[model samples]
Target chain A: MANKLVAHMRLPQPISNLLAARNIQTAKDALSIPEFDLMTLLGVDIEDVRDALARISKVASPPYQTALSLLEERLINDASSGRLPTFLKGLDAVLGGGIPFGVLTELVGPSGIGKTQFCLKLSLIAALPMSYGGLDGRVVYIDTESKFSSRRMIEMGRNSFPEIFYSEGMAQEMAGRIIVLHLTSLSEITESLQQMKLRFLQHEVKLLIIDSMAAFVSGDNERSGSMSRDHLLNCPFSFLKSIAEFSCIPIVVTNQVRGHNNDGTSQYSFLGKDTDNNSEKFMNQVPALGIQWAHAVTIRLIFEAHSGQKFIKVAKSPISPPLAFPFTVCSSGIALLSDDGIEMLGQEINVIRSQGFFSIFDAS
Target chain B: MEVSALPISPTNKEKLISAGYTNLASLVIVSPIRLSRELQISVQEASNIIKVTLQCSGAVGLDGRHVVLRGAQTAWEMFSDEQNLKHISTGSEDFDGILGGGIHCGEVTEVGGVPGIGKTQLGIQLGVNVQIPIVYGGLGSKAIYIDTEGSFMPERAYQIAEACIMDTLESFRFHRKGAEDCHERMQPNYFLANILYFRICSYTEQIAVINNLNKIVVEQKDVKIVIIDSISFHFRQDFEDMALRTRVLKELSQTLMKLAKKFTLAVVVMNQVTTKRTDGSFQLTLALGDTWSHSCTNRVILHWDGNDRRAYVEKSPSLPQASASFSVTGKGIRNAISHSKRVRMM
Candidate 1:
């Protein structure tokens, strides 16, 4: 193997003559020789030895796949695959039946607005069999925040599928099918995504979810202080896009929101001072990963919290309008809001406010 | 014992022993460049000596005993052993008492506050305090100060060192005779020499310094304190992509924590503050938000209470929620005056 690897390296004649004289027939043998020994034996400069090692390594590694091959592979796979239903009626309607396969769907929202809950619900939904309104496949839920909870999944599963949950060992078996990887860094996430390509080929994984992509990448642009941040970000996004497209797996990524201002008015104006204007000013809440990241996603869903209720707005979708609706997260998971539920929510807010339940608000 | 016991040639062994490679442990830690230069040997021979010394030191054991996985019993024993734990003092008695002695080694302590509130002062004070000789109530160790915000003042450090030297000399005068003869050892230059300062202008430099810190600490064996004055300075601005920033910050903190644990050093990181609007009002919070709040083992917040500088222990494992009043004077951080004195002056 070492000899074959060295045969691929086209070194200068002088270097080859030195190698032949020293009986170094292989790259491995040459590398195993100390730098000082190599220099002394070859009667060459240290730079020449370094160059030889570099050339050996370059030949040893295989070349990357071409773009034409990637495109051919994508075409060979089914490109017009169907969407995976999110199991929320209003959300499914806004997302045109559900999140589409062979594309990247970004879920952006602020903290405590059920972005994670929605992803968790999707993970369970993807794991369900087709007979019970699911894609009937496994899920790769890459949790960056260490917030992936199997206990919560069990609670949601018990609510969604009582018959399967109450059955002996069924719920545990179903939950086992969904793979959760807790990655703490961007590089680790990139490596895991690369490795998951092989895992996806072996397993029946239909969905790939990175719960809160912003949790890892946030605040790095200033630290790097170079233009390479966009390049560094492009690798994972492009890899995810290619993997989703080639394998026809739906990729759901969650992102955090930062405060944005348009025309001198705060977009997330929950202050109630501009009640009439605030409802129409939903475009100012920018996603965390800048415009470059925004352009990478096929669809962008923005989740917001307003008046003790959660709202999912289609911020930027290729097929849908700027539509939104209220939803509530219960022990059963995210459910669409009803007319009576909205009235009850209003009364609950009034009751809490009148009773001074949030005394910190008053003190502040 | 014979020098021939080493793997080198007889002539080379004599040279190595003459160059102070008499012991295996010392040979294991010495750099190859120093060995080669001192002994006038080839770099290859020096590297071979280092390799042999490392193997003999049980660092890379052939029997795999060096990599044994200990059970919870060993962990519990290590946790309960008080002598094994060491702390670097913050130089102020009140601050040290608030910290339950001082900042313990093998833990990351974050000091956060609004601008001009003495976070850097405390960092410099700790850098100076780390050099206090073990006989004078200190760890007698060096410090690696990685300054991101350029707040590390050498003049201030010299003043603190001078005050510390004076304090040590006064104690020696009371405890022993011929204290004046020890003036050279008590010089501020000696204290300043123990601090390795690295001024990082960008986050990339910060990461590079941190990634190579283990190597630096190993080369400088006495480095027991790592200070990054204002870890959040470069991170708070120009970060259009929050996700990338968070990832970098998380990775950097993890590396710092690993260095702290593996090298048994006190990692002190300084952070800035942002006014977070909660409940229709502004409240001062750490710059990196909730994601980074849990990264540090201990968090101390410096704030102003009238004319005095007050420190609050926002988070700690062994210490309770506590507050102490300390002021950063020209001579460095010191305990504030008593309330009785203030009342009398008023």
Candidate 2:
């Protein structure tokens, strides 16, 4: 509808040339820019700007929704939303299926509690064939710490779907679909995200995973010290969120746990107690990127490994309580624990919520 | 450790392997002249290969046509590489046990603790212990001890070296039984010669020394374990610009990661702990905040358990979370001798 208007308008030569050069091929693209900024940005005359905006605005009207209508629309949309099920520890059940699409799902955990594994599994799921219960699309896995292992992906592919992945070109085909971009600095990452805007269409991307967002945040922000606190806290994340919404793709970013400070004025110590019920969990540590970040993410899941047991908690969600699932990683990716396995994790919620791991050690 | 893992040209990789230098460990510490002679390649190409391998995370494709290794390897490859990596022992079997063999190369391991939990002792012990011969399940690598706190004492290193020699000789004699052919070539002075110590008095010098490790490592080749005793020492004091500090720290860790990868060396950053009041109680957290925590592949927290000192493997990708009690005996780091296991200390 928007593309049809561009040709039908048959705008002036200079204006069409300018819009063509800017790659504003559709009315949606032209209308995305504000009226005033268009003339300045494109270095065109005010007459050309007005003429262009007049035509483009016809096809792409500004969206104005009443609360009641929005509620109705949301209800219809939410009725049977698509989810990428984790298929582990009955996590999909609590997650309202699997992790819901079209939202920022932050995986918060300390270093090496299988954060990378969880992300890897999801990426594989995103890259799997539709017949195999996958998104059947490409994945953009941005690794900040150079932690993404393609070999492990192959092994997991073989483990999870032995016949499919092992059959001739299946592993190679799957591997080719998941694009891995390993960058360390903030500038480079944001730059990559910018490039990804163009890559989304060409690649048919369904998912974006930043293995660990905190890996380079402090260091990168510190290097470019001139960036304001507002910039530090907002820019990259908001940009990522925009990319998620714009592309209609799920973005899974992992956040590392930072030690909390009571004084709270320290640059990196803004992790507030959000999950009141899990105050004990936050007593010793809080997620990196702090409160603004806490709000930015629509869904959050915490991965904790104590002794030998690994639990994934739905920390912040609209659908479920702060419930945790005891899962383990195997050659076949994260698997649902057996009944005996859950038995071994017996009284885990009560024990963890009440006594906590540190308290137990202290008692011993 | 395979030549394939290096970001060199495939043809050159095949040439090097065909010429009998199969693993990267063989490439390290070897002069370019020998490589040039053996592979029949020009001195320039050989030197370029060595230089590329010596670079942090590395400057790839010294040949200009080749590119740096992409960061997207499979975890299976990492697992296999880790299995082949030579661990520099911390001079205590028990400490080594908790560390999953010892301080692994190609990863940054941060050890933090209070002022006197024998952090310096462990640093020096590792500096000497890394010199353990390759024939004896050791890296046979040199050490770069960047002392930020001026706490790295040469005399203490000498004492530890002497003890190391004694233990090696005693073990050799015990294994040989009645044989009297113990070479006695392992000397404290000889061990001291291999440890390249740099005393960094300020933050600037600390940064400079760490940044220059790549060049130094290229030239020295065999310099495997780089220990920065108390990485937080200079950063904890002085300036008010936490933002600038964070930038500098991040830059430093990035450099360390690169160096660790390119050279397949263990970069030990000994950090000091700070007390933070959270939820009405003070808690001990490693200095430089949570962002710094992700800098290292492994983090071992040295804490005092009652009257005994304990080192906890707080964060590790492979190792289980566990702790082992060790004492700072005159013989360097050893298993904590309590009650039934009491040993005479010098």
Candidate 3:
């Protein structure tokens, strides 16, 4: 049985011989020998000893199962798990509760598309206490372009939860919980992600937000041609994915988009005839970092601007169908427009057209 | 005793010493495969030995100050060396004058223009001109022509080479007694033979060619000029993300710059123009945008001025903002004779 278990562990031949020589016949026997003793006596490195120990533990514990089995187990244990509410009623409903944990969620769009505004709103929502539909955990905001604003967060907080913001110290306390890291280069971002395992544990970071992942990865230095840019990009993304899975945190990353060319036809139009055409055109907006990057995300939300109004569409999602909703970004932050509000705005615009007068509009 | 100081067995130490890895530096530079085969050790052990040797020699250090200081002096010496500062002639005297001497060594020179504006013609001329013997006021070095847009015409290169050889032979006849004696050896085929042409279709292949350029340069020791005819072909069309494209382009430029400095080679990169909307008016700009503007040490814009092809010195450290009217004839790029000069000569 000892030999069988030893064979099952699949350790390096040298390490196995050393273990056997030391009369570590079983997994338990190997475990009993201190890590220091294994390193010094066997003349093996710390990494090898750790690997051998891990393999031995795997053999000693319950049998290894497929990812499907583990995922199913997790599903049963926490049926309402993984979903973090975005706090917007219509947006939350479309998202099937909120952004799911253990996966990378990408929010991509062109400039002035409310992508950053949505992210800011999510960051504030993630920092709120459990009673207020938040994760009651810290937020990690990795800003690559230095566009993150604290004043906007304050205003959004004041608008969404006036009571919480009105309580003088509460706003500061909430703001303090969201840890913002301004990383400018791809290498710096990679280094930070590598060291974030410790930071995530220490700060109880539950939400990870990279304001714009495309900015740093696409810098001029990467053009040096020494290393593959695709691989350089894949490193941090894979690291972020692993971190999200291991920490059970929802990693929200934003990406920039370029005008998509379909069969040499201009697909993007500011004002279109039909809603379906607009959404289809918005869907075709090629997300940055290429197709490999597009596949890395579990959910992809695209923000589009049309004729002075903004819309958020579920471009790609695992749990939800593709949905589009009109949203307005104001001093209060990103708020979803109700179906009735859309019609009301249309009527108001018609009235203005009939009156032939330009009146100042209030978004609130 | 020195070999024994390393954490290796006595047998391995004896084997390593027998393999002539007598010192730390020798061990650090030796290939791991050779070390493993000679010492009858694992590849991992050979790698570890090299790592240890490098660590002990302080060649591979964490702080990098030691390496930088050591390299700075060597670089300074190389920089000061007159032989290392030689420039390859661009075949046109006026063009060479605008470029200080010609396409300069140890620097990246970018030629920007629209299609059919004689950019490729100049590139072909430079490729043929770089092969001119050092005795004939040339670098006497080979050229590496990386064609990204399939614009590299060997027939045109032959024409340019024939013209260059004729010019050189004529000049030699005026200067020397027996110039026609060695005319057979200085044929256009010889010039074409010296130019190593690499047709790169994609960005990946272009990068591969740039990365492996050092090996090619070392093997072909006479190669001193590297030309990439249009660097923006694959980059502009295939790239959806501006940042990724910028990074890749930046990396390519850096690699080219390193190659230029290392080999003291003149790197001439051809760039296409794009119409950019600035201040509510469309103006012609370099294809890769403002990010790549600083990548080149010098940028020369070639455009059309009616029937004559004009070259503009858009940006250069040494050269002033200037324009030279040049025409592309059946022979090659030549200074366009002004209307006044033509009348005076007549």
Q: What share of the true interface contacts does candidate 2 keep?
A: 0.00
Most accurate candidate by lDDT:
2
Candidate 2 error regions (>4 Å): A1-364, B1-72, B174-185, B340-346
lDDT of 2 by residue, B131-219 (tens): 87655446677888886554454545777888987887767654654333324337776677788877554455555466556767887
Mark the regions of model 3 whose C-alpha exceeds 4 Å error after superposition: A1-364, B1-68, B73-84, B177-184, B340-346
Cα TM-score per model: 0.41, 0.40, 0.40
**Would you give me the overall lDDT of model 1?**
0.68
- Give the lowest summed-lDDT range of ten residues in model 2 chain A: A343-352
Candidate 1 local lDDT, residue B261: 79
Please give the range of 10 consecutive residues that has the lowest summed lDDT in model 1 chain B.
B337-346
RMSD of each: 24.8, 29.7, 25.4
Under CAPRI classification, how is model 1 graded? incorrect
Chain B TM-score in each of the candidates: 0.75, 0.76, 0.75
Which regions of candidate 1 are displaced past 4 Å?
A: A1-364, B1-75, B177-183, B339-346
Worst 10 residues of 3 chain A by lDDT: A347-356
Alpha-carbon local distance difference test for all models:
0.68, 0.69, 0.68
Per-residue lDDT of model 1, residues A1-364, tens digit only:
2343454479877887777777887654654444556789888999998677556644432222221233244346533336788777766765557888777888887776678888888988888888988877889999988888889889999998898788999898789878999888888988887877876766489899998788766664452322354445655776676687557788999987654433222111122334324323433354566544654566777676544446666655444434456677889888878421121210011111111223424555
For model 3, how does the per-residue alpha-carbon lDDT over A1-364 read when each residue is reduced to its tens digit? 1223564567899888887787677654554345566689788899998678656654443222222233345557542255788877776775657897767888877776678888888888888998888877788899988899999888989998898989979999999998899988878877887777886655388789998988855544322321255445756765676677667788899988654433212111111223334334434454555444654566777776544555676655533433556677778888778631221111011010101011214332
Query: Of the candidates numbered 1 and 3, which has the greater TM-score value?
Result: 1
DockQ, cand. 3: 0.01
